[model samples]
Target chain A: MSNHAFIVYKKEIKDMVRDRRMLIAAFGFALLMPVMMGVLYLVSKDSEAEARNTMLALSNIHQAPGLVAFMEKREIDVVEFEGNIVPEELPGKADALLFLPDNYGEMIKQGKVVIGRLYVDENTKLGIQRGREIGSAMDAYSSYVAGIRLLARGVPAAVASPIITSSYDLGNAGFFRQFMGNMILMMMLMAPFVGGLVVAVDTLAGERERHSMQPLLAQPVTARSVILGKLAMVSTFSIVSSLLSVTTLLIAISFIPAGTLPFAVYVNAHTVPLIFIQLIPFSILIAATQLFISIQVKSYKEGQSYISMFMMVPMFVSYLKIFGGEKLADFALFAPILAEMESLGSLFFTGEVSVSHMTSSILVSIIGILVLTWFTSRKLQSEVMLDAA
Target chain B: MIIVKDVAKAYGDVQAVKSVSFHADDAKITTLLGANGSGKTTTLRAISGLLHMDAGSVTVDGMIVADDPVKAQASLGVFPDSFGLYTRLTTREHLAYFGEFHGLSGTKLDAAITEVDKMLNLSEILDRRTEGFSQGQRMKVALARAILHRPSNIVLDEPTRGLDVMNIRLLRTILFDLRKEGRCVLLSSHVMAEVSALSDHVVMMAEGVVCAEGSPAELIARAGEVNLEEAFVKLTGQEDNGERKVA
Candidate 1:
């Protein structure tokens, strides 16, 4: 770095540190974002687990002993329903309600259909999934009875059921797990952006609004030196906030009960350092991008508007990786934010090294910083700079 | 010493400064006297290497501003049209920041600040943030920031605009002292009495061009007027404008 650039860097850092608003903005994202997301993950995980643990309240249970026994064998805890005939909501601990008629057994023995209604809450996704599972189990019991009836009639049961198929989930992660997992990665990537945003806008656009750019540019320093100094200052905030976010999340993860999070988190010492290593240059790249955006506008408010818009780039890329990652080609998936997610996902959940993705992220980050810094520095010399509003 | 040879600049289709030319020699106070919108600020900015001239060149201490702005800027200390103080920084800190840009640091930097503080009576606000500083205190810091590096040429645009009478007198003394040290001092203002009192040579600008130039007495004599203000009105033909302020 040039001496002039270093001087600018030091002054900007000191200036930023003394600003209470900047400090709050920088630390707030680092401290609160991860904890909030972690809490959300825990809630989703518990709800999913609750959905899987089926509890059914069966009405007229005495007339359906075989059905009740079948449900108990299938691990659906069955309880007697004694109060309201038609409850608006599920009874205290029941995931669903199974209604049976008084002549249910008699109809079965007479070979007539026994009609019943299964009321399951469809308010939440978890509710819908639980309802589907309960309906599937009831259908299985009905098929079992028909097979038995067929065998007693001297007809081959195999004739009734020609195809035999079973299912096994290929992936261990559940629906809520995958969603929260993608969310966590997005939060981690966004932490640095939120951290540096205030400082980035203030450094260039704020200076211009204050008309300080005129005096600073009047000095002997080159625009390159001035921009480099600002870029370094913004990167300082970005790196600190991002690293703090990772560390806070690591500590938060350590405190959670084992196997509680819906998704896997492999935050050991090795992966933690690797995650930091990936983020340092990536945070710098984000800093350059933000500074580049901030310089295009002439006022602090205007710069904030543009830089906030630039923030959407990360969010858009993160969402693409989360939802469309599988459908996206490898080249698209290995872009900046996507590449970072791919590497961090492994370091975070799978405990496998994604070296190619990591290398690509770092290389792309370096190239991006250089290109953005070049453009931003050139913009500093534009004639409009001389006549700020 | 600074020289502007037929410098021209424009914004869009509107010409801000057109074919302006002048010389500021060492050991002399040369003031650009003009009415508002007379392009004084643009001329000062061109000398400071802050703008790219459309048609001509600016050279400070034998270095061309357009060809090598840094070298040209190193030889010039500029007080821009606005004080542009950083409200978060102290007077001393502001001095150090601009001082460092000029390659001043450590004991040398400290000595420069101490010296400037003594000259500008900045001891009271040296360590205080500039957030609530009075106009006079802000002017002191801005002037100190400009001259801390001891450049060969000092250029100020309306430096005394918001200062009280006392601060203006103090600034006048400093400009005279700088001239005594053989530094070229170029400044712009329309206050007739101030221009008459401070300038050894005056370049009168009207509508982006030099309307008149010479010593105050010489211009007054040339325009067949009794006072410098009368000479200004008769020379620039600003008699019909409502914005002329001779005071």
Candidate 2:
């Protein structure tokens, strides 16, 4: 049985290799993630530059000299706006704006709550970070004023604040590493899902549509073996392409200008194999399910459309794991698609993947591969899948 | 020999093959002459174990297809109506793939490819990919792949549907050679001239069952017609030289 499957595998791989153009295209798409990572690094570096010299358009700076001094001390460039400048119009006009309402100094003396609007274009990374810095600086100024008020009332500054709260992050990885973790893992997850899509669909539905599957099925091999052969070929391509993409990402990460980020973003030799290992089972699952859906479709075009749409499922799962910053329920760790992504995240940020999480992920992926392969094999044997029959 | 006995199949509400039965003997070519949707492909599929029959049995070389489809398939070469050629694979590669599929390997696989290549005059195109191959070239590669393993039985569906006169003649010679080697060659075709010229036994099917089974001469006599074409139209209840009613 295995021998026949290997024969099928050899033929499929040969066919795929002969269609080098399609493979090259898939590889190109896989390389996009690494390319995107490089682009993001450049953008982040630019944003870092923007943060150091944050330029905020101030409409009423004369009313808040103390706030102006604090802004200058923090290296925030205070630019004078001569006309009415709206925060919503800040996209191409200015990075951010600080609007101090009229009578702001009188309200401070009267101890009335004064709402100073800090308008920022949240769309840009620099605008968001600079806005955060200005808010914290406002807090520092308010506390400094509170200390003076307490001294006038014959009280020590410690009377106003009893306890100082600070958090100790257990994870020692730098900000860039944590930030790139999602983007990198997202890229890794996408590598197999996107890379293996064409091969998986073409080997089955495309072959059937071209009338080649009939002769293939007529051979002395079992249907299960044929399915296995196709699955093995597609999974191998996906895994290899994902590994290459991961390697490319690592190399790309290494080329990132050192100190461009506050945190170090490194993909060591250990992480490379670990990332590849985490991605393999997911690749197998993707290949199997792709073939499963492709077999059910009538033609290559139909299969392509359906597989492209179906690819969004894994991507959605990966994105959810990346963006859903909340702690996940324990049961979620066993979910096949999300588990691999989360385990990869653990490996990157925490430097140690939880044993239970890894086991669950591996188990779910293996089980998913088996179940999908079984269904695909059953479909391959059915006459509905064999148009020539 | 390939024997199909009372094989009946239905797809949803449509009864495709209702009690179809026939036997193709060794060392002879059997032709299934039918119009469109006459269950010719369905019967072949049943014999190849590609489709399970609702009722009845099919056996290839004493092995029941349902019980031992792999073993039965090993002894039979099926060239479906569609040529089913991989455009990217060269003619030699196509032969090697099927040769390996039938358990041929190493020198045995290489020798089989060379022999089939010589017999089919595929030497000129063996190294060329099949993407731009003509219909005749595609048919030759598909046929060579089917027979590379020297199966005892060969089932071909619509083998001469789109062939030029020269290619048809070449196919005739190949079919004769297979028969002479004691291989059972069962084929389905709509072309009466080729059927009458090549088939030693003709199975006339109409509306999912065998309407008549005999030599071309016998069928012509049974229909009281001068030629096999009129006989086929008459046996299937369709008027000659008129629009064929949809089955």
Candidate 3:
């Protein structure tokens, strides 16, 4: 930084510190995404515990004693229902209800299969768990009956089932990492943008609106120096905010009950610095682009409105990695927000950080910063922007 | 010394300033006297290098403002019309910022701040934020910022516009003191009394053109008017109500 630029930076920092409303607004934005993630963790934790201990309401239990025995052995507690007709809607008396027909015994005697009705909302967590439990128990009881029938015909019971199937998960990180990783991606994408917002607008449009631009510009300082000073100030604040946000989120994730989730929830110590390094170019890009747009507008309010509208572009782009998933094109690695999102996903989920993908993303962001810096410096020199004050 | 030669500026078809020129000599006070829309502000902006001229050039202390704006700006201390103070900064911080921007640092920067504070009688409010500042208080900080670097030339755009009697007198004393120190001081004003009292040289503008240029007495003699105000009205060809003739 030039001497003049440093002077301006120092003054701006002090000025920003004294501005209560702006500080509060900035602090609020910093906390927004992390707080949202914390709330999500709490809600998911409650439902997960409920799913572990599912309850079932079984009707006409005497007709399917064998099926009832299987459910009970699996630690699924049952409440008996003795009505001749099953209720249309399962009364909210239990998580889910199983309705066995009076003809269930007759069907079994005739060597026929009987389909028992399972009533559940399927939307609630407990309801879904109960439904899965009843379905698995029914499958088990039917297979046992088939084995007995096969032995009675003078055939080996093993002939009925020659193959046994099981699944092996290939991923080391559980859905916990992927789920939290997505949230972290969104927060990282927004961090630079939200952090630099007020400072960028204040240095450009705010100065213009307050009629301070003329005197400030009239100094011996070069236009480029002025621009650099403002950009440096904004970028510093953005990087700090991003670091704080990610650290807070990581700490919050650590508090989550590890046993409740299928995968462990923890962030590696080295990952924090790597994430911050990835954000450096993004912070500079956001600072430059925001300042460029801000200097064109006439007032702080006008700049804010334009910037807020422009933010939707990056915001929508960030979500492409989530919704598009693996279906995204190979060239997505060279895109701006999409590339960052993909890199973040890989880093957290697979614990695999692709140097090629990250390098391309950083290079693109740096190019964006250069282009915006050119325009912003030009704006500072332009008589139109100066005279507007 | 600052010289603006035949500078013209136009905003599309409006032509805000046309064929304006003036010289502010060392150790003297020069004023641009004009009515509203007569281009006083535009002329000042053009000379300050804030507005690029459509034609001609501005030379500050021997450097052309157009060719080397930074070097030219280094010699100028400018107080623009309707200047804004950063409401969140203390008065001393404002001065220190300008001082450092002008390349002063260390003890020199601190000394400059102290000097400006003393010169402007800003000690009482030096540590306070500028929010809710009175007009006079704001002017004090703005003027201090303007002169903190102690440039060879000082330019003020209607510095006394909103000042009360005491504040106006204080500004008058400061301008006189600055001139006594051999610095060229230039200001723009429409108030005839202030122009007559403080200006060693007056450039009277009308409709974006210099209608007259001379000392106050010389302008009075040239217009054959008894007073400077009457001379100003006669030279600009305006009625007492400040309206111009159809021609």
Candidate 4:
């Protein structure tokens, strides 16, 4: 490195360390990941435990004997309530209240039946969903009773029920992984916004505010060296932050109980390394994007706002993929944050690795860095530096 | 020596500096005297390669400033009116950082630091961070960094703009010593007394153009005034009522 470039880098690092806010921000990010994940893990575990221990109340009025028998077999306490059940006690005393309305059996016999209402607290959506599962069991018992009654009348149950439909998920393990990978994808996408913003704002806008940019620009160093030095410092912070975040997430996952669901939370050792390998290019893209934004803005506050606005890009992309049911196209896998999200989803849910996808991601990040460097260099060469000075 | 040949700087349609030219030879303190918006700082910035000129060229040590900015910058040291010091760096670190930028290191860097420290009288606060330093101390530190490489050309824009009488005298004595070392010093200030006391050559500017150029005595004689201040007012076409105070 040139002496001027080395001095610039050393000074920047010194300033970053000395500034309490920067240190707090960098360390705070690292601290935030572990602490946040730990808290979330504990809260989730507590909630699951609470749910499992909860007792539910089932009320079947004019109910078929078979449905009643099934409830008894399942050990669900049947409470015969004529009027509205106590709303406040539903959450604490009962997980959910099952309400079987009048003439339910007659309606089933007529071959046209209405499902009973599952009374639950609106705030407890999870409890309501669980109540529906119990309701489905009751429906199965009702159907069995009606089928036996039809057989006794010399009419085939198949004749009465002419149409039958069933559904199955055709997607492989990769698709399942992608579904569960949303959270990781979202976090990985956020890496650029979080890491780049801090580095860029401190490197360019902060220097301008401090009135040190003039002397820095007046040095005999090339503009490229100046920018690269700044990018290296900021990228170091970002990469460290990303690694810490991923580690914290992994630690949190380790606390999850085995056999909690169909999928495993424990990532394979190889998977962890692969995710980190993919993150390298993603972090570079983030740092470059942030540096570009930081150099364009005149103040740290403006840089912060720009970063916040850019943060929305990843969030929007994730939402579009999830709720919008948008399939990830091959081309989308090359778009910076989008690529990381898709790659993370693949890695976590299916344990699948796409070398082509990884290569494309690397190329995209390189292009992003090049474009950002060009514009930043042009800005450095312009009168903007003088005005900033 | 530093030479500016017909330099003009324009920002959009507004010309900040208009075809102004002058030269500062070694062993002389040349002062650029002008009113507000008179393009004195613009001229200094152009010489420092901080601003690009629309026409003509600036040469320091026979190297064109705009064409070979790095070489020209290496040969010159610029000290603006307001010196900005890094709050996180100590006085010694600040000097060392700039010394490294000028390609001085190891024993040479240490010797340069020692020389600038003694010259600027900053040895007492060498280890202290500059966050709590007084304005005079900051100015001294800035001067120390600028002269660490001992460049042949020194450009100062209002170096004593804000200073106590004692500090101002101290800075003037330092500038006198710098001049004795056969270094070309380009100074810009509105203070008539300071300019008259220190400047060997005076270039008066008005509306971004050189209105008059000569020695302090020559300008005074040419303008038919008793001192350089009245001469500045006369050359720039300002009414001189003789009521302006000189500190």
Each prediction's TM-score versus the true structure:
0.96, 0.88, 0.92, 0.89
Cα shift from native, residue A291, model 3 (Å): 1.4
Model 4 pairs in collision: A177-A349
lDDT tens string, model 2, B1-247? 9998999999998999998888999999999998888899999998988897899999899999999888899999999888888888888888888898788999999889888888899988999999999999999998998899999999999998789999999999999999999999999998888999999999998778888889999999999999999898877776564434565
User: What lDDT tens digits, residue by residue, belong to model 4 across residues A1-389?
Assistant: 55556677787788777877776676565556656544544443435634453344655544656565676676554555555454545644565676665666777667666676666654544555456556655666666667777898898988766766453557553333444456456765565467556657878887776677777666666777788777777777777777777777776667667654335543698888988888876787788778888888787788888877888888888876765545666676567666676667667766888677777777888888788877887787776666552
Report how far residue B132 has shifted in candidate 4, in Å.
2.4
Please estimate how well model 2 matches the true structure, expressed as its whole-model Cα lDDT. Answer: 0.82
Looking at model 4, residue A285 earns an lDDT score of 70
What is the C-alpha lDDT profile of model 4 across B127-239, one tens digit per residue? Answer: 99999898899899888878889989888989998789989999999899999999999999889999999999999988788989999999999999998888898888755
Q: Candidate 3 on B62-106: residue-level lDDT in tens?
A: 999989888888899999997688988889888888888788888
Which candidate's lDDT is highest?
1
Each candidate's fnat, in order?
0.75, 0.86, 0.88, 0.51
Candidate 2 lDDT for residue B178: 98
TM-score for model 3? 0.92
Model 4's TM-score against the true structure: 0.89
Which ten contiguous residues of candidate 3 chain B have the minimum total lDDT? Answer: B238-247
- Predicted structure 1: clash tally: 0
TM-score of chain A of each: 0.93, 0.82, 0.87, 0.81
lDDT of 2 by residue, A189-293 (tens): 778877788888788879888888778888888989999989999988888878888778767667767765545543566675776678788788888888889
Query: What value does the lDDT take at residue B101 in candidate 3?
Result: 76
lDDT of 1 by residue, A38-98 (tens): 6776566555447556888888788788888998898988899874488989998788898
Query: In model 3, what are the clashing residue pairs, if there are any?
Result: none
